[model samples]
Target: MLDFTCGRAIAVARNEKLQPELLKVGELASRAGVTVRALHHYDRIGLLKPSARAASGYRLYDRADVARLHQVQALRRFGLPLAEIGVVLDQPDTRFAGIVAEQITALRRQIAQASALRGQLVQLQRQLQLGAEPDLANWLSTLELMGAYDSYFTKEELQRLPFFQFDSQRDGIWGRLVARIAALMAGGVPAASRQARHLALHWMRRLERDTAANPDFAIRMGALMEGEPSARQRIGITPELKQYVIDALAENRLRIYANYLDADELRRMREHGGKHGKQWMTLIAAVHQQMHAGAAPGDPAVQALTREWFALFRQGAGDNPATLAKMRLAIDSEPALLAGSWINAEMLAFIRQSAATLQAPR
Candidate 1:
């Protein structure tokens, strides 16, 4: 009980050798590039607390505490909130490993987003390099609309659309067709009238061309026009006008087909057409595009398409040559059918040549 200062001094000397180096709040803040107040706040929030106290009752951070502070800073750089950082740190080693993997995935996503943005900027730069004036306002609006398009169509779908094709003639045709339709509407021409039927044929041709005759694409375009107010307003195809076209087309097609097929034949034709119409449109459009691009009927690509076209035809028309002949007769006799359909005389001739090419001895 008496004279214990020497023993206490010896104990302190031994402990000093075993203990790790510790830092005060100010020292840690200075070395770690944070504020002392931030350390204090971390302590209050149970995020980072000192392990020991000095003889003067000041907080002292050990090496482990400094390591934790490093981790917190790293997470902060990654945009993690302090509360989330605390939870991440407090997790068991296995869970912490999973969080590290999540961080890696998030970083990759950020890199991908950055790359996509860079691509867009590069495209704009190329446009400018090609002697096009850089209209900043128009570019900004275009980018905004592109984002809007993203919500409606996938990247691949947008790439396939006529928007990227630069067909001024096609666009001009569309403009004039729309103008004609507008004038007819203004004149109070009924949708069932002869003028409306003619307009419907033009409308179908334009629609098929614009969509490349992909029914899915056309459906998506319709959905976009219906769902997006900006698209509807810009195109000026109001729902009423759209409905009028649909009604007129349906009536017109029925009137054209009724001339050739008896009741039973008409029923089977309707069923077959309904089942395979979209695929037929897509194939026809592909062939039409190839012909327009000046591909020869004997070209390998065209021949491949021709084989598919014949296979699809047999599937629809069956093995009965009579049915095929009758349908061909109807098409050959009716001008309106050709007007209302993609199977015009030129297209039919192209298909026939492709068929002969496929049959000729190689």
Candidate 2:
């Protein structure tokens, strides 16, 4: 009877060992791309357990253990805490596809946020290169503001915007411009001042120069100015700046025709006061002249002008001078207009108005 009982025990042990043949612990770990030590640790923590041990004392896992390891690895890849991973793996009816889908969604969101952060960092880097003192706190605050309007902007739009940077001399000139503009707005100076108009002309020319060099100018400028409505409001530029820019743009169109129009062609074209034609033509001409001259858009004059305009747009409110300078550099490197075409008047007008509104006096 004792011999018969022993024979039965041996048979039972052999059957148990054979049952786990599909997944040895090492093979399971290897399949899951994890270390064997990791599998052991999971077993020690009760997160996963092998079904049996062989005669050689090697751990043997079944299909269920292999599945559990897959889930744990997937969750870890998604940045879940190990504790949470354990809880998820322990659930009796956890749907693998559902869990994977949820993780994928989470990863997508994280990737988008990281992309935005990288964009913001690039702006900061540009500012630093231009010798601007960028404020981390303000940058963070700006990012928060941007998040509020995330839906209003596409990823492409957000990526194209510029940040402000500071330069002492340029900042000083910008301060003066802002003060002058604010005083005018307060005292009701006409938007079409000889000085103000000249300022506007200077701004347009400078912008043309900068954008000619930096094709990304419009996008970066949009990003810097549009993210904070409160910043615009603080500068007292609620409505007038938009109208002011509109008028200035009209004036610029006139100036372009006056300076560049062919005499007989001008008469044939009914160019009364050289107004109401394409606005971007003037910008194109300006850019063309600069290219012909082989001038760098980030020239000191351009930087000073950008600083002044940024300050003026803020209506004496502070901005990141360095960021603006960097943006100017970028603009100088790539012209907004393509080789055979300039930006459309409507688009230019819209961008100009929007930028003005964003930078309106506070």
Candidate 3:
């Protein structure tokens, strides 16, 4: 009888060993991508209690317990509160289908949000490819400002905008330049002072480099700053700074003209420039647009622009050959003068070629 009882006990032990496997809390937490503490919390809350306890008083999780834990995590990710998750799990019936539908809707929303985020990242990547080199802080700030940019620019325009083309070297230079100007202002330096004039020329050159490919960029940027207070604050260009820069630029121009113009010529050029400044701005914008679009100098559109350009140039230079020659020399010799006018040698060559084509015998 003793032998038979021992044999039955051994058989029972073998059968228990052949049963389904169970996992300790640590093992289950690792497998489910949750923390052991989180599992303990779930157990304490009766949300995902283990199915069995070992003789050593340790909690052990069976397959069903793991499946329930997965459900709880899924509901949590769907933004369901733990209390609500337990209630939802308890009512695993036709109502469960409704819950699943809600989860699907939530997942769809998450996917759409993720896609939009991905699109912004792609846009930033393109900006980087185009020569923007923002560091971590600036990169995060740029991401934050992407939505703000949408209110002011179209997607295509944003793609072409060089607003984000700020490398550390240029950023450092700009910071120093602004600081120097602020110092001059604080020290009571007149805008017409040589020091201010020099800094103003530097400012114009930097702005020209930023907006050279698109003349309308400067106008739109002004509009953006005027319309968006946050943008002004972010860029650190207050209204006072803007006016100071403008005054300094005017002085810089005066100095340039004085080098090449008599009193009478200066008076005439100033009048002509003021009278037709808007028209000149319009023409320059058109020429830049055409150039950016790859329009050849001989294109009919370019020929028309060339005609308008020469007409405006003659007016602004006082329609005198010698004055025109002097103005041309000033422009050619002075980088600051070119920056002020938003015209480069390449643009001039394009316009000149178009003028030659226009003057060619038909």
Best by TM-score: 3
Our model 3 lands, by Cα RMSD against the true structure, at 15.3
How much lDDT does candidate 3 score? 0.73
**In candidate 2, what are the lDDT values of residues 1-362, reduced to their tens digit?**
01112221211134453331355666665556779998888889888888777666677665566666768877888798878888876678878998778777767656766765776687789999999998776666655555544544455444333222222344355446556666666787776566666665554544444344343453333343465664443333334664564465445443343343345433432333224223334444444344446545455433333344444323321244543343334333443212223344433333334345455321
| lDDT for residue 360 in candidate 3, whole number 0-100 | 37
TM-score of each: 0.41, 0.32, 0.54
Candidate 1 lDDT (Cα, whole model)?
0.70
**What is the lDDT ranking, best to worst?**
3, 1, 2
* Cα-based lDDT for every prediction: 0.70, 0.51, 0.73
Per-residue lDDT tens digits for candidate 3, residues 238-258, read 888877887787767867988
Candidate 1 residue-wise lDDT at 76: 90
lDDT of 1 by residue, 103-199 (tens): 6776765675576577667767988799877667655654555566788678667656764344446756776877788888889998878899889
- The TM-score ranking, best first, is 3, 1, 2
Off by over 4 Å in 3: 1-146, 156-162, 165-172, 271-279, 360-362
lDDT: the better of candidates 1 and 2: 1
lDDT of 2 at 95: 83
Residue 261 in model 3: lDDT? 90
